[model samples]
Structures are given as C-alpha cells and as structure tokens.
Target: MSKTSQDEWTLEIKPVSGWFHFHLKDVWRYRDLLMMFVRRDFVAVYKQTILGPFWFFLQPILTTITFTVVFGNIARISTDGIPPLLFYMSGIVSWGYFSDCLTRTSSTFITNANIFGKVYFPRLVSPLSNIISLLMKFGIQLFLFTCFLLYYWMNGSTNVHPNIYILLTPYLLILMAGLGLGFGIIVSSLTTKYRDFSFLVGFGVQLLMYATPVIYPLSALPEKYKWIVLANPMTAIIDTFRYAFLGAGTFNPGNLIYSSVFMIVTLSIGILMFNRVEKTFMDTV
Candidate 1:
C-alpha cells in the first residue's frame, strides 16, 4: 500500500477515561451484537431442559400455590382481601422479573470475562442483553398471571377490580428493569475483586424478598415496623402492582415517586462504577 493510503487509515484504541464513559452510542451501534447476546441468554437457560419454555409458566404456578398453602392457609396471613391465588401470583410475577434480572446480570463480568477480554464491543451490551432476555421470560410469566387474573375476573370474584392504575404497567416495568440492571452491574463490578459479594447475592435476594412483602400486604405490617418496609424501594412497586390489578393494596403516589428517584440514582451510580471497573477489570479478574 502507498504511504498516502496508509496514512488515511485510522483506528484508535485507548483506555476509558471518565467515570461515565458508558459508550451508549457504541451500544446502539452494536445493536446486532446486543440482540445476539439476548438470543443466546434466552435460549441457553432452557436449552436442554425437558419442558423448555414451559418452565416459565410452571415456576410461578408452583410458587403461588406454595405461598397460598403456607402463608394463606396455614399461617392465615392477610392478602389484603385479595384472593390467595391472585395475590400471590401478582407478587410472584412482578418480583420474579426484577430478581431474575438482578441475579443473572450480577455475573456479567465473571461469566463473560473471556469474551470481554477479547472483544472490542461495548461491555454494557452484556448486561443490557441480560435485561432484554429476562424481559422475554418475564413476559411469559406475566401471561400466566394474566390468565389467572381473567379467570378470577370472569368468575365474579367481588374483590377483583382492575383499575386505571393498570396503565402504569409499562412504566412499572421500566422501573424494574432499571433497578435490576443497576444493582446487577454494581455487584458484578464489585465481584471482579471480591468474590464474596457474589455469594452474598443469592442470600441477600431471598432476604430482600421477605422484606419487600412478597407473601403479605404492606398493611399487614405493624405501624411502627411499616416504615422499615416502606423504606425498601420495591415495596411501593409490589403494592402498586397489586393495587392496579386487584384493587386491594395500599397506593401512595409519594412512595412511587420515591422509587422512581431511587432507580435513577442507582442506575447513574451503577453505570459510572461499571464504566470505571471495565477499564481495569481484566487485571483483577
């Protein structure tokens, strides 16, 4: 090649500088890679399983049944006047999506270290893909919840009352995705150096579920202790979802606003930390 032609070629590779160099545009440019990763994640989970995608429906169904038997029937926990089946199913479906995104994406760096080491694509793609893939799974589970909802509604259940708050479903989903991706990447970034955080994630998530009122309504909490549960951002989400669908839970606009703000802050901090870590994570990983 001529010197002039060689001079015309340019390819620059440099270390990420700023704390917020997320390269979101690069994520857009590599949309195809994002989708590919999404597809791989979605299929890989159930690849060799006998029931395949059917497990999506099966999981929530079984979980709701157990909650109904253990919490509703045995312990006689209050579901805020909502039927056991519908109440438990609603919380299961909502929390399941958020937790799945959190758990799966928390391993982003560790699970895809080899690829990150070799590839030039945006590292954000990995976690973003996880959110997308999990969204698909969440959709399936939501459909199952909807079917149960329809059955109860058609059966003339006096308690079932779908309200205008249902319109917030899409916005509520975004809040879930944002919170999960934010927490997941933050933990993933930390796990590069301290593997203990990864171990804590599972235990922490389970404890978090109990704190978030998955089995009982927020109203069931003691007045003094209620503030503690209200402090959890997910508390508003679960309650709002139930209120929207079954019209049987507390709904405070102030709480929802608090959650939205929390999501924004968490996501901003998580992305900055993630961008900072990706630059030197190979050394630690």
Candidate 2:
C-alpha cells in the first residue's frame, strides 16, 4: 500500500493517563453503540412481561398509594398542606428517576463484565446509556404526575398552587441526573474491588430517601436540624420540585446553587474515579 493509504488504515491505541482523562471524544464517536445500549436497556426489562412498558406508570402509582396510606394516613406526616396524593407522587417521581439512574449505573462494570472483557469501546457508554434509557422511564412517570397535577390544579378543593418556579423542572432533572450519575459511577468503581458495595447500594439509597424529604416536606422538619437535610444535595432537588409544581416546599435559589455546585464537584470527582478505575476494573471485577 502507498504511505497515504497505509495511514488511512492505521489505528492508534494509547494508555490513558491522569485522573480526569475520560475519553469523552471516544464516547461521542460511539454514539451509535450508546443508542443500541439504550434501546436494549429500555426494551429488555419488559420484553418478557405481559404489561411491558405499562410498568413504568404502575410502579410510581403503586408507590405513591403506599406512601399515602403509610405516611399520610397512618403516620400522619404533614405534606405541607398539599394533598397527600400530589405530594407523594411528586417526590416519588423525582426520587425514582434519580434512584433508577444511580442503581443501574452503579452496576455498569459488573453487569457488563463479559462485554467489557471483549470490547474495545469506551466503557462509559454502558452507564451513559443507562442514564438515557432511564430518562424515557422518567418521562413516562412525569406524564403520569402531570395528569394528577392537572386534576388537582383545576380543582379548588385541592388548592394546589403551581407557580412560575415550575420552569425549573428541566433544571431539576439535570441536577438529578448529575447527582445520580456522579454517585453511581463512584459506587460502581468501588464495587469493582469490594463486592460489599454492591449490597450496600440498595439499602443506602433507601435510607438516603428518608433523609431527603420525599415522604414529608422540609417545612415539617424540625427547625434546628433542617440544615442537616439541606446538606444533602438531593434535598434541594426534591424541595424545588415540590415548590415548583405543588407550591408547598422550600425553594431557595441558594439551595439550588448549592446543589449545582455539589453536582459539579461530585461529577468531576466521579469522572476522575471512573476514568482511573475503568483501566483496571476487569481485574478486580
């Protein structure tokens, strides 16, 4: 072959160095593979089931009903004067999206070990695809939440007061995705070495939700300890979501800024950890 033709066939593979060195350009180059993974993740979950994608709506609805009965009716937890159904559904929808991303992404290495062992693609594709697939699920639940919101919104008896802050919904989702993806990749990197992290992820996420004002409003939290919950990045996301749609929770721009900062820092650190681990995870995993 002529030198020019030989150059066209050449492929360079180099070791990645540095903590921040995630070959994001490679991820973009593999966008087709990413979409394939997304489709598989979205479809494979329900392919064998009778109801299929309907479970997306059913999961949040059933969760909201359970929360209404247990926390609202039985425990008498305050929903900050908003209707119990709307309040719990909002929290469930928001928290469910974040948790889904985190839980699924956290298993990227282990779940796809076989593929990783044989593949030359960017490893980040698995988790990134997970986040995207879950967004479809999130959209479905958001639609269901919107239906309930419209009902209570039109009804004077419910007194649901949606405000201009509703515009922040998209921003809230970005924050959730950031936080979930950041935390998830970090946990996943750790689990590559320590199998115990795999066990802790589900239980830890459940406990974290209770601390995040999902079942109750931040307003109901005791005054002195409110800062503790506020320290949690997800607290502001949940609070802003409730205030935006239901007009019932604290909505501090400062809190959202805090969350933004938290997301950036966490994601940066996660990418650093993820990049470092991806190089060697197959050995530990």
Candidate 3:
C-alpha cells in the first residue's frame, strides 16, 4: 500500500474514556447536521399552527400584559420607578429566552428517541440545535420588547433610562444561554431514567421565574431577603439586563461573577452527565 493511500484511508473510532471526554471535535465535524436540526426544530414547532411564528411575539406580549395587571396593578409590585409595561416586557423577554431554551433542551432524549436509536451522530447536536432555535424565538420577542421600549422612550417616560450598561446585553444573553443549556441538559440526561423529572420540569421552571428577578426589580427585595434571591444564578443575569435597559435594577459585579462561575460549573457538569447518558440512554429510555 502506498503511504498516501494508507494515510487517506486512515480513520479512527475509539470508545470515549473518563467523564470529561467530550468529543467536541466530532460535534464540529457534524456542524451541518446541527444546523439541519435547528431548522427542523424552528419549523416543526409552528408547522400546523395558524399564527406560526407570530406566537413568538404574541406569547411575550400577552405575558407582559398579564404580569402588568397582576404584579403591577393587583400586587402593586414596584418596578423601581420604570413604567410597568416596559419593566414587565424587559423581564418577560429575558426570562422567556432562558425558560424556552431550558424547557426545549430538557426533552432532547425523549423527543428524539427514535432518531437517536436509528442513527449515530453527536447527541449534543440535538440540544445545541434547540438552543439556536430558541435564540431565534428570543430575537423575535426582543424586537417586540424594543418596540415597546422605544414607544415609552419617545413618550417621554422619564422612568425608562437606558444606560451604558446596555453594552453588557450580549454577555448577559450568552450567560442566559449557557445557564439554560447547562441546566437543561442535566435535566434531560436524568429524565431518561426518571421520567417523573420531565413532569416536574414545567412546574419547576414556573416557580423558578419567581426566584429569578422577572416581574419585580432586585432593588425591591428587602436587604435581608436579597441574599436569598442572589443565590439563584439567574438573579444577576436578569438584574443586569434590567439595569442595562431600564436603569432600574441592581447590578452587582459580585453577583455577575458568581452567576458566570455557576454557569461554567453547571455547564461542565451537564455536559459530563449528557456524555455519560448518551452512551446508554437508549436502553433505559
């Protein structure tokens, strides 16, 4: 055999060893498949629906209105002097992105069981695709939120003071995505064995929103209870987002650092668990 021919024919397939051995290179090699899955998730979601992608815009809008009424009017939650509409919309947009990513990615194994069983590709692609699709949905909701922000700004709403902290918006988004993807994959991996976790995810995410600073400002929390809310990694991300756009929430560097560290740790653990589960989830699932 010629050297060139032997080299051209070289192929390696080895069993993964250790918990940290994520074949990221393989995932990169299957990038096209990842995009395909992303497109599939995006289209299949609204495929027979009357409104289609409009639901992206409508869901946040409706939720913002409901929060404005319930939390703003009824409970009289302080929005830290920002207009209730804008305040709630900001929270809704940020929280919605995280929640949507987490919820969708959490079902990777069960939803794609048949495909996983029939084919061999990087399993991470499935959840990564969900993150990308949810990002698209987040973009639509963000556009709607920007429209409201502009309307309020033009209307001379003094309470809505967008600041230079808005520069952190991109970082905030990346953190939110990391946290969602991390926690989601963890849950998805576990749900393969314990199906009940799937049922609990919905309820957990709903309760999680309250823990996160979604409807209310971090400043509104009394000093004694503030530490409790800060314990949630999402607290800093959402608070920073609100402060950036509305200039009405707390923006502690310590909190952001903590959230970033938590995201890294959670994502590391989630990926490890996912890698472990993907090898044998078919049998258990």
Off by over 4 Å in 1: 1-11
Model 2 lDDT tens row, 205-247: 9999988999988888899998889999999999999998888
Clash number for each model: 0, 0, 0
On TM-score, the leading prediction is: 1
- Model 1: per-residue Cα lDDT over 10-108, one tens digit each: 765577676756688888999999999888877798998999999989999999999999999999999988899999999999999999889988999
lDDT of 2: 0.91
Ranked by TM-score, the better of candidates 1 and 2 is 1
Model 3: how large is the Cα RMSD against the reference?
2.5
Which of 2 and 3 is the better model by lDDT?
Answer: 2
Question: Between the candidate structures 1 and 3, which one is better when assessed by TM-score?
Answer: 1
Q: For every model shown, what is its TM-score relative to the native structure?
A: 0.95, 0.94, 0.94
* Model 1 C-alpha lDDT versus the unseen true structure: 0.91
Mind giving the per-residue lDDT tens digits that candidate 3 earns over 145-234? 888898989999888888999889889989999999999999999999999989989999999999888988887888998878889999
